[model samples]
Target: MKNTILIGACLLFAQQLVKAQSSSYKPVEGKIMTEWAAQVTPENVHREYPRPQMTRENWVNLNGLWNYAIRSKGQAVPTSYDGEILVPFAVESALSGVGKTVGKDNELWYNTTFSTPKKSRNDKVILHFGASDWETEVFVNGQSVGKHKGGYDPFDFDITDHLKSGKSQSLQVRVWDPSDEGPQPRGKQVNNPHGIWYTPVTGIWQTVWLETVPEVYISGLRNASDIKSKRILVTPEVAGIVDGQQVKVSAWKDGNMIAEQTVNPAEMAKLTIKDAELWAPGNPVLYDLKVELLDGKKVVDAVGSYAALREISMAADENGIQRMMLNGEFLFQYGPLDQGWFPDGLYTAPSHEALVFDIQKTQDMGFNMIRKHVKVEPATWYHACDKMGMLVWQDMPSGDMGNGWEMKVGVLGNQSDRDRTPESEAIFREEWKEVMDDFYNFPSIVVWVPFNEAWGQFKTKEITEWTMTHDPSRLVNSASGGNFEMEGTKITGDIIDLHNYPDAKMPDPEIFGKDNILVLGEYGGLGLPVDGHVWQQKDNWGYQSFKNQDELYARYAGLIEHLGKLVEAGLSAAIYTQTTDVEVETNGLMTYDRKVIKFDVSKMKSLHSPLYNK
Candidate 1:
């Protein structure tokens, strides 16, 4: 049996080191530097736009450098600053300019100075953290104002009271991440980085900024598309507002208004377009939209955002095989295994454009789908996939496989694969539900994969059924690989799936449901690109790496063509190894930095065109 307790500690280290910057970003081996290096400077650390859903000309970019130091587990802030670190990257990340680690016995601390916008006396200021891993405690101007948990979701704190009012202010963050130490939604991270597991991010891994809102402001917004009705439902999260307040929604395309509607906050606000344009990978037409709160007649508060009209489902092919359907047609969903990591940003892409490039390359490769494996992406990622017509199969990030070869994936693999204390089994089941609820709102996501190779899997029948009941619209993959047998066939499975690597073998047609799509959950990790472009200079590898771009292109062309032959065998979709190089994993079609494409774009797209009709 594998010592999972040791594995948990290793997961945390994996996340920090996975930033994988070879030369300038090397770790200090065993030395522990708690303070972030002050070289990059906080003012220039992360200077990009915070929100991509909507744009406003007046907002400020609060990403840059900050003073950081890692304190002992129960210690307070250090008396002196050791160095400067990048604001957004965690202290453990080399890109953070800190290149440090705060192990299980430490707390990462960050502090920055900022001046408020010259606002009137009535305005209120609110600070937001795009995301923070594990547990976080926030303080403003020395006063402990708020704190939060949950690594993958966004949260905020109103620092108005803790502010210096008219003077320059200080904001501070104290964070503690146990990684696999506790029952949180951590994806493939271990203390000892090896094989599939990588380093852990122990602090603010996403953007940290502030936005000023009216005393009575719009707290949040939820947008859902009703494809059958050709309409949408918009709900506002408003504070200090009456229940019957009215709000207006306006749809804009390229700075022009195409549709408009007004409604009481009681029911869904419906808007229609005479000549409607829906979003897909090829066209990716997005209509810019904004919503404003109306107090009787005056515009009180507003927020900017956009959405597309799209639908995903399972449909029957002519031969009665269940197939994955997009917009009501069985288009074999083919694309790369997108791990969503970066040479610099890790979970956070270097820039928004860098994030979009991965999806663009997959589309260029003629794939309309991406299996976002064991990771939840930033909001902009799904927006790009939705616009690019790329469908997404989102997996709930699971943790630590249990003891023994069979328990390794936990109730997966051959021989029932189940081995774990009932205590651990109960924890795994609850965590799965929490992950689904956190990401249930994404429109581009069509499938929920609960267990992949049985990693930490157990009681799948109850879990899969729970997922179906929680979100019935999407398809579910009960167990991705390992231990899939004839007896436990009802263990919460909908689509029949199989895992392949480097090469894809066809699925058996008769065994697949005429209603459940036949899917190759993983395949085609063919690799090879030039030097410098490689994440690692000597040790880089793939399931099969090539010598040149032409050869790589030829192999991918031949690989997909083979899957095309399996289309008649009830096959509806397939996912390749990955979208980019992650840590020691080099199976991505593109390098980690997004600098080069291993295959010719036009040629790859042309080759992929046949899978749709196949």
Candidate 2:
């Protein structure tokens, strides 16, 4: 009888192994995957808390496999799903388990179920989406909850009222993205991807989760710091607050409490940190923050947060040229142009470790900053930048292209600003503001880029001025490598930028550096594709393709040798072509799959050490 039972169990285990090898729910074939992609499974896809800036304890991660269907636009929710798809991975990506396209003509629908979290009578359940592309509408228990229309920022819906009494509830999400057909801020995504533009990502590409909060909770928080004053501002956006309810904020360092403050919901709570440690690239000191909502003295709701007391401004260098200053000192910034894309997961990384790998690699290469070119990353990306002491230059995703301008750098363009329709203009304005507000708290972000090479640049002066005024904490690069708008004799933004390829070049300091900080927004595009580690076998090209690693490193080192001279000539910052190879652009320091680092890390670090002191 015991042998019979053992035989039956052995047969079951063998059958399961076969099923796993030929699993129907596996990543699609044909694309190069990162090391972390092999670690991904349905049970462990982006399990980390989506929001690290603002976190709560009681939450449920709604990631993993979900029933997905692509139907015609405006069609009702489908009765049957086409197949199982991995949540947070776009349908066009291989990691999604269904590499397909929805396009503008169809709507991607997702259906899932979750058990209700244990909550008290006064507890409110909130549904959160870290991010989704284009237009998204949510339905809970077959009832429409709300709709959101931004692709790059986080949004949430209060689902307490829509909850069912039973332990289980239904969640339905419908998403429609017009890609390049509409005038929305989609960075480098085109229906027919070629050259610089790549694949279209539809539906949810970020984490979706649920958290439980009290009846009156802290809905949002805005953290800002003043290095000169040695204080941090904690502004809490509270919901359902009444009389006698107050908000208390406390700061801690190295496991010890440093400061605390209490204020009303509408007022900003200020905590003064004496002898505060300024956050910089070398010493990125982050103070642990705790915010609580109090009813008189009893705490009603609380959240864990953090802050960095750092300041970004502009000042004059010894050469009488404007220089970008960090904490009142000029630091020549140099880093790669980071295009946050993956071969397996498009915009979404396969895991939290995968998302952090690029940043870590860049630091390993001895770069201090990253130019986030034309795309906004998840909040966790910025948090990683903060914790790792990396400076960030955030760019608003470019869209609504085809605006005409002169094809020249270091000079004013023949044309300036696209005459966008009222609808398109309003869409651009609203989304840019939302992106700024959502990421204003991260101390690593030192620059705000409004337009990139005039892709969809409209109302340049108005947008640049507004961004500078809205966030006085960070300098605004009005148009990076884009058309120039002059206010009499000066440029409209804080920096006068130029773009050159292959060889290192800088904005003519004698012409505009004295008034504006001079920068080479993009320069190096040295490519050397490794065998068995490229997106394709042929047509993989860079601005200057090399035959071997020796040639690439020699050219890259020569470019740095000349860039140091420009730094002495009032050049404040420079950005290389990219952090990793994307599609056929083989100009990355590392390969797209992240399996190979083209240049030696220690050698690259030694090559970049002189830029800081130059």
Candidate 3:
């Protein structure tokens, strides 16, 4: 496939006035690359469509370079500028072009200018942000438009009111990320880097841009798929009409329309298919959807999206061991441990291709599943999974500081007083809910994990119950590892998620099968070697590391083959050590730089294929 995205060469000059491209830049302090490190100016940072689940052709890409200034907290906008920082990549990331830092006591500011596409009298312009870390307040033409708190979910403000008859418009944004110094969900970031904790991403870690729409528009659409019933449900967020609004929905397979439906504003509406094509790693079938929110004679707003009919559930095998079943058949899900970090971007990847490239490479190595360990991905990542046929076991990005010995009782790291603090609990719960709400629409996500290895884990019963109630559509894994019994024979879910390191031993599956499903949450931290392709030069760590690619691949094949044998011996799914190397960890099948795929793909697939059948 011909790649290497090409835009107008004129954009190169236009981008220089905005900011430098960080993609071409490099820094010495870290391995993660930032968009600006390569000098990505406003002409291009993340020009790809931010929302892959729902897309529109008229929307514009606002990524590239922007004037950045680092000022004291609550400082007024300075007429003077510090320099250019790439949009989307945080200031801490090398890809930001300007390799600088945004700390706890400072505010990161951005200013830019763009045109309104010379509106045709009735069109309304909307400003979009894929995501920004911590807290952000936005203004356009020097007028405050809106403010958002969460870092993961996409947010936007209608900018039609801020635009004018002029050929161009001015935009401004302010951001403050507290990192690990505050109560917010900062994930695995710390001021100090050692062991697992690395760097923190602050301010505008996602794409930002503007789009023009009609006076009335379909602002959002939630597409939900039922694997058992072969139906897709869509709910639209509309703005044009109030009472008795009409919505037109269409479903397409390949290029042909298969079904159609009409419904009123808000709530569960269906678009059914006769013989639904189930989405699998080998045959990923997606159905196109065109939903329009209308008022009588005119179409107010419209959006295009796609979904696949797929199911993941826990079912008892002939031997009575509960395992993950896909499309009514057992498929022992095998995948890498994904830390979701980047050398240039830290929390963000240098480019959208860098994001999809990770998943694609993992799949190429013959794995169908990924344990998105302790991090959430941009929407485009999930969309890539949908298109590329990868299974996802999504983990809530972990945070809160407490050591191993303290986090016992299996609560999964909630032993400290912070876990007892009601305010902390509320904040964690709210942020978790925001994440669930953000990605709930993606069909590729098969499981929702609330806690891992008990890091900052507390209030297990309440949190697990809330997870189940909030998202009954997918499986819930409580405390992937804990000192105390978390499943407790009471919690309900598709699989009993267990965690162990480099050991093939199973955790007495007989006890877990009574009330809930059974599966190995983690195991097999096997490491391999390749010259000139590592995240760090020394003090590398993995559950086990090897001398060369041949030896590593051979040992890994044996390990996975042993896992396949365990499928009949009562194993459902097992998450391998990792997708790529992170910081000092070298167990990944691929190096952290992502320039190499260290495994033998065909051999790995051959060993894993039999796990589903047995």
Number of the top-ranking candidate, with lDDT as the measure: 2
lDDT for model 1: 0.69
Give the alpha carbon lDDT tens digit for every residue of 497-563 in model 1. Answer: 7676767764466544554567787878877745765545667677887888778877887887788
Give me the candidate number with maximum TM-score. 2
Worst 10 residues of 1 by lDDT: 30-39
- Which lDDT tens digits does candidate 3 get at residues 57-113? 887777766789999999877687898777788887767766666788998889998
Residue-level lDDT of model 2, residues 405-509, one tens digit each, is: 665644544466888999988888898999999999899999999998889999899999999999988999988885978865478989887877878887677
Candidate 1 segments whose C-alpha is farther than 4 A from its true place: 1-46, 54-58, 117-122, 254-256, 403-442, 482-493, 529-540, 545-554
In every candidate, how many clashes are there? 32, 0, 44
For all predictions, the C-alpha RMSD in Å is 10.2, 3.1, 5.0
Ranking by TM-score: 2, 3, 1
lDDT of 3 at 79: 80
TM-score of each: 0.84, 0.96, 0.90
| Model 2 stretches with alpha carbons more than 4 Å out | 1-24, 408-414
The candidate, 1 or 3, that scores higher on TM-score is 3
